[model samples]
Target chain A: MKENIFPAIRLTVICLLFFSGIYTLIVWGVAQFSTNAGKGEIIKQDNKIYYANVGQKFTNDNYFYSRPSAVAYNAAGAGGSNKGPSNPDYLKDVQARIDTFLVHNPGINKSDIPSDLVTASGSGLDPHISVQAANVQVKRIAKIRGIAEGNLQQLIISNTEKPLLGFLGTERINLLKLNIALDNLK
Target chain B: MNTEITGIILMYAAVVAMAIPLGKYIGKVFSNEKTWLDKIFNPADKVFFKLSGINPLKEMNWKQHLVALLTINLIWFLLCMFVLMNMSWLPLNPDSNASMSADLAFNTSISFISNTNLQHYSGETGMSYLGQLVVMLFQFISAGCGIAIAAVVFFAMKETTAGKLGNFYFLFVRSCTRILFPIALVVSILLLFNGVPMTFDGKDPITNLQGDTVQISRGPVAAFVAIKQIGTNGGGFFGPNSAHPLENPSYFTNIIETISLFLIPIAMVFALGYVLKRRKLAWTIFSVMTIGFLLLLIPTVINEMNGNPAIAKMGIAQPMGSMEGKEVRFGSAASAYWAINTTVTSNGSVNAMHDSLTPLSGMNALLGMMVNCFYGGVGVGFLNFYIFIILAVFISGLMVGRTPEFLGKKIEAREMKIAMIIALLHPLLILAGTAIASYLYAHSPVAYAGWLNNPGYHGFSEMLYEFTSSSANNGSGFEGLGDNTPFWNIACGIVMLLARFLPIIGPVSIAGILANKKYIPESAGTLKTDTATFGLMVFAVIAIVAALSFFPALVLGPIAEYFSIY
Candidate 1:
């Protein structure tokens, strides 16, 4: 045991330097050539900047809402509501969200609302919503903006990202980009 | 087929495909056979040994290996504790995050060093850059330690006479340099290209289109996440793990990270086959583990894709399935697939919140940890499965009225005692720990109100899952459990320590003892361990042991919740 201790200590020190210092430096150096220089992907529009991947709050009637955020889309920290399926209080919260969605879009029935629209996401900063989530909100956005609903539908279709290789992952739309496209419409 | 199902199929295909070749390479590294990358790593490993003033070729018995593993792990624990508690004033803490409380430090340190990675604190707020780096160090070494010990056991299995196993330091260094480092580098670069951050800068404050000012946390996440998945450490750079947008970024990055979770563990099985010169044995073991994994996985995917029944009653279409605590990009199918993969392997890094999974799906996650040997965590995973193999061998031998021998060595009462104790220890720790917590929660519901996020059956599950994860050294949590308190921190700390070392000690000791015994060559009377019949026996042993012990707890938690909701 005593003989092993010094070797263990020496090895630990060397490993700490190799893994923490050198390996991290290599990754950091390579990241300098990556997108946005590894500061994360960012987008600038009309003097406002947004993280291309980070979800944002979109409660206004003029924009498509991202999924509900447990941390209110606070990027400083990420979390989920962690509410179990059978929890009455969590179900109540979902019910409230559904009622609110119905209130916003008068013609859209409750069944038309996708579950993603009412439920909070795991990361609280999920940038994308299912295509169906964006589609359901087009009516409210069109009615408020006084744009033809057909144009908004076209925007949704264009912004919709197909599943990777058309077979791996889900079809979704980036809420931040879609809303930016909404404002860019002439 | 739907994209979600197709996505899962592709992910599994990619993992198995990668694991086969990687497993062969790992086998070569341990066997000291020449490999393509040996030129680069051989000299690099020599530096590590010289710096440590140790000879790489020095022979170590099983006891020496355990001592070395534990001592270094202890040092790592102290180093991690110091960094975490003092990072507020330490260099490179750009976020200006405060230091952790003593109890939290204890939990975090033990959690990482044991390879559990059960986080009591959120990374973005609780950890500074320096702290993240230190934890990342553990992510590499702890995993290397596990892989090294597994190599030791492999050596023990191959020897026909009492002899020293290979040096622990040599195997450990080689594991980090030749295997973990190269893989992590490739994965990290891929993540960086996909927008996972790799910077030492402070948070980027950005104003969204809504005119809301949000401080976007960014750091060396790509590197951290790469090792986290590859090592099966599962400690995230952020609290939400892979679900965090900046941490995972896109579906492509998601596929990469998910594949990493299965890579080394599945490879280790093949490595065992390679080292033992028993390819059929490896396939048999792989089949057994894959069977268990699919059993848990298929149900979880189906349940998650079915969405929540209670929400369905409220008249909403769940075209995307259950979305609470899940991301739209990965969808329910991928998230559920990741959930089962993470648990079964003891990877414990969630792409979605396990707490919010449907009751049956959540139960499957728990069962994965409860069974705890389906693929499992890197090197230690095989150690857990080895215990089952011994138990099965003993029981089947008794049933057939023959003395048990495995791999040409006799299995006697000493080995059976160790195997039984180690197998039973998992349940004992989980059950006892949960029992104590339940008593506390029930005895003073008002005082411990914050202990549970949901009431009734699901709440019981949160407690059960926590202890099971700790005992299994699987760190994914039912995060709803407000578990940052002193009770949880200290309780889980001790549990993680005991669970991590004891299981390793049990298996290595058994193998070491058996290796020293006289080599009894296989005869007509000897049982064939590599046969499909033996594989079935092992599977039956795991099912009976894990299911019988954990069923009552499951009844109270997810099963009750399932019936109540549906």
Candidate 2:
């Protein structure tokens, strides 16, 4: 028992030093080659900085819709609402989101609202919306922005992120990028 | 789009391509053969052995190996628990996080030691830098311990008429230095270069476009995330886990993280072939596991891609499938694939919320953990599958009127009893734990704080998923359970320990005892496990055991939730 206990404890201390101290420093050194040096990808547009990797809330109808966030797109405290589907509060929140969307897009049916638009993402700040989510709001955004629906559709098609390997994930659009494009539309 | 496909193809190609050689390299490492890295790591190995008083050349029998494995694990557990409970005074604690409650510390220590990494506390705010390092250190050692024990099992399975398996301490050290360290270092650098933060500083404050200030938690995340996936210890550096922008910044990083989860587990399968000089048998087992993995993966992907029918009824089109809990970068397909991959291998990191998944997809994840043998954790996966193979051989032996013999060892009551108990123990712990939790939730008002956040079927599913994940030693949870309470912290701690150690002991003991038996030449009538028929039979046995044990729980939870959702 002593042989086992003493050696195990000694080896563990050595491993702890190597993996936690030395190995982490090595990884930190390699992070120097990465974009932003692991400080996060920051995009400066019109002198305002935006984290290109994080979800940004865009509530105005003239722009493409962003996914709902339980944390209000707070990158500092990223998380889902941790609410179960049947939780009345969560269900009410979704219902309220559905109501708000219907009021903005009068022609859209309640059943036609994508769940992504109404429900908060697990990472409270999901930057992308399903291709269907973008499409459902296309009518509302075109009417408000006065851009031709055809041109908007073209932009959506161009921005669609295909599943990796055409087999890994579903197609979706980065709402931040799409809204930025919407503001730039001539 | 085409480039995305290319990336996926390249990643899969890379894992198999690299794993084949990695498997052979691992084989050589354990056999004490001369290798290139031995010059660097050999001296370190001797230092380790000397400090621990382990004789590298002295082989231990199965019992001694088990004793060594358990004692060392306990030592690490004690060390980790001490650090966790006393992190307030520990150095490098920039955040000055307080010590964890005794219950949480016990749960966390056991979780990491068992290679489960089931985190009940949110990491960013809950743990200081000192605590993070403590957790990261345990990740490496625990994963190494698993591989070491697995090496012993492989040795026991192969060496006929030898009473001794290899040295546990030697295998543990070699596993870390040769296999886990190199792969983890490479992965860490890859992730660091892909934008995962690797700083030692405290949380950074950033003001967003909305004019709201937020504190961005930064740490040695790249180092932790690398081994978290590579070692199959899926605890996150942050609360949202890999879904965080800094943890998994881009599509490329997501692919890397997902691939890392399966890489070592898959390599271990190939290593079995190389070590035993039985490539056919290894490939057959690999096929059985992969087929099971793919079967679950495809349905989960399709269900998630189909989106939720309840939301569909609200007149919203689900053209991009289900995106409820998934990130846009990951998409429904990738997130579903991750769900299946992580659960199948005991890698519990999540890029999306399992709780938000559609009913059938949720069930697919549950079933993967329930079976708990597909691909599996680094070294322990094959150990679990070996149990089913032994049972299959025993049952088939009875039908053919031949005494069951595995690798020249006669199967007897003692061996069968251990295997049965080990196999039976998994479901017993899972179901019993869930039953107790459910009862407490109903009868005891004191147990009702944050226990079930959702009522009805989804609520039941959350409780059920927790126990299944714990009992399988796959620590990903539904994220909806308020599991930080004393009731949960202690219950799951006990479950994770028993679930992890018992399965390991059962297989290694059987193999160790068998290795000592007298050799008998193979006859024509002897069962060939490498053949397709026998592989299918083993698969059937796994499916049957899983089905018989978990069907009621599944029906009451995910299946019921599915019907309710539709």
Candidate 3:
């Protein structure tokens, strides 16, 4: 037992020094060339700074609604609400989201609210919303902002990010970027 | 788009290209023959053996090997539990993260030691630097332990009756030094170059462009991330796992990370062929596993790329498929491929969320883990598959009216009993655990509140996926289950330990016992295991066994969800 135990421990300690120390230093040095020097990509708009990679919350009526967040879009502690369908709390949460969406967009029926709009994204910081999620809220946004529905539709068209190579993820709108564009519109 | 497609093709080509030579190198190292690494590692091996008074030439019986494996694992487990539970006082805790609770510590210690890195907690906020080190240490050791046991079984199959299996200590060390560590170092360095953080600092407070400040947690991410993927240890440095930009920055890193997950396990298969000088048999086995892998990959990619049918009803353009739980950086094709790759190898790291996948895609993930033998984690994958091979050989031998034998050893009733037990144990643990969790959830609704994120069939899948992942020792979660509570922590911990150790014990023990039996040389009348028929038979055994046990649970979960979604 000692034969294997002692040598195993020795090798483990040796590995620890290299894997934890030297290997880490090398990687830290390499991170130097990445977009933010490994500090995450930052976007500066109107004197405010935001991480372009992370999802931002846009709950106002004139802007596109961001995907529901489990952690309320806290990038520092991002995760999904791990509620399965059978759980009453999860069902209630979805129902509550549906109710809230109906209240905001009175023109849309209860069934029209997309799951993406009600259920939270896995990464609570998901920055994009499904094109349906974006479109469903267009009426509410147009009514509040006094913008033409066609103009809002055009804005949606301009803000849409196509799937890579035309067939990867869904066509989606970055709520932060879209709302920024909306705010800029005269 | 052409670049991405070309890149995917190139990655596959590169993995096969690297695996062949790497496999040959591994064969040489383990066979104790002369090799290039002998110059540096030879001295290191000798010095350690000399100090520890271990005879590198001394062989161990299967029982002895098992004991050594268990004892060393127990030691690591204790060390890991202690460190994790005392995280607050530990050094390098720039975040001053509080120590984990007892149940979580138990769950985590068992999870890593078992090589199933099913993390119930997020990385950045949950653990400190020292805690991550402990986890990283276990990742190497756990991965090494798996390969070493496989090496033991490999040697056992080669030796004559009562012949000695190679020393466990030697193989374990070599597995780390010659195999896992070197590759991990290179990959870790590459990831560093690609922008994964390796700093020892705590959370960095960032003032965003919106003037809203958020504290971005940081740690020794690069080193952890490297081994985390390569060792098939998928515990992430951040909560969203590789989905987080820092963990997997660009297409280049994604391809690298994806390749690293399968490289060693695939190489080990080829290594078996090289070592045993049975290239045909090796290829036959490799083909079966790869076919099974690609079979699951096809639908997952299609379903995810097809996007959600429900969304299409709303007249939304879904040019990209279902991007709900996936990142744009890693599109549907890559994410779908990654889902199967990670599950198949027990490398549970995710560039996308498995929980957010369409129902059919989610089933694909569950099925991969349930099958659990497609180029599994470094060493144990081959070990797990060995059980099926034995059964197939025995069954075929019976069909042909001949005595059952494997690699020259007679597959007697004793051997059959062990293999049967090992084979049955996988589904038993998964189904039983899921049944328990589901029954509890069903009977105790209020108590199980917030336990599942999605309701109905998808909810059942979260429970089923959890157990399947645990029992397979592939630690990827459905991610929607509130799994951090005591019930999940303790329950899954038990499942992980049983699932991991029993498979190792059963297969290695069978090899050990068979090693002591009378050797029968292959004759013209002997059943040939290297043929395509034998491969098909083995695949059938895997399918029958997995399907029989998991079909009902799967139907209730992913299949039902699939029908509803469609």
Query: What's the TM-score of chain A alone for every prediction?
Result: 0.98, 0.89, 0.89
TM-score per candidate: 0.99, 0.94, 0.87
In terms of lDDT, the poorest run of 10 residues in model 3 chain B is B1-10
Q: Write the per-residue lDDT of candidate 1 for residues B517-547, one digit (tens) a residue.
A: 8888788999998888999999999999999
**Candidate 1 clash total?**
0
Q: Best by TM-score, which number?
A: 1
Candidate 3 displacement at residue B459 in angstroms: 1.9
- Model 3 lDDT tens row, B116-206: 9999988877898888877888888899899889988888888463658888888887887778877888887777666566666677676
Instruction: Give model 3's docking category.
Output: acceptable
lDDT of 2 by residue, B1-566 (tens): 43333444555677778778878888888778877898889887877777756678877888989888898888888888899999989888887778899999999999999999999898876898889988998888889988888888888778463777778888988998888888899888888877787777776666655456666667788889999999988999888888887788767799889889889888898888888888998899988998898889878877887887766655666655676667777666667878998999998999988888888888899999988889899899889989998998898889789998876668889999999999999999989998988887778746495687777778889999999889888889998889999989999999999999999989998988788788777789777778899888899999999999999988998788777666
User: What DockQ does candidate 1 have relative to the true complex?
Assistant: 0.90
Model 2 vs. true fold: TM = 0.94
Off by over 4 Å in 3: A2-12, A29-52, A58-68, A81-121, A126-186, B1-10, B34-40, B43-55, B159-162
- DockQ computed for model 2 against the true two-chain complex using alpha carbons: 0.47
Flag clash pairs in model 1: none
Task: Give the chain B TM-score achieved by candidate 2.
Answer: 0.97
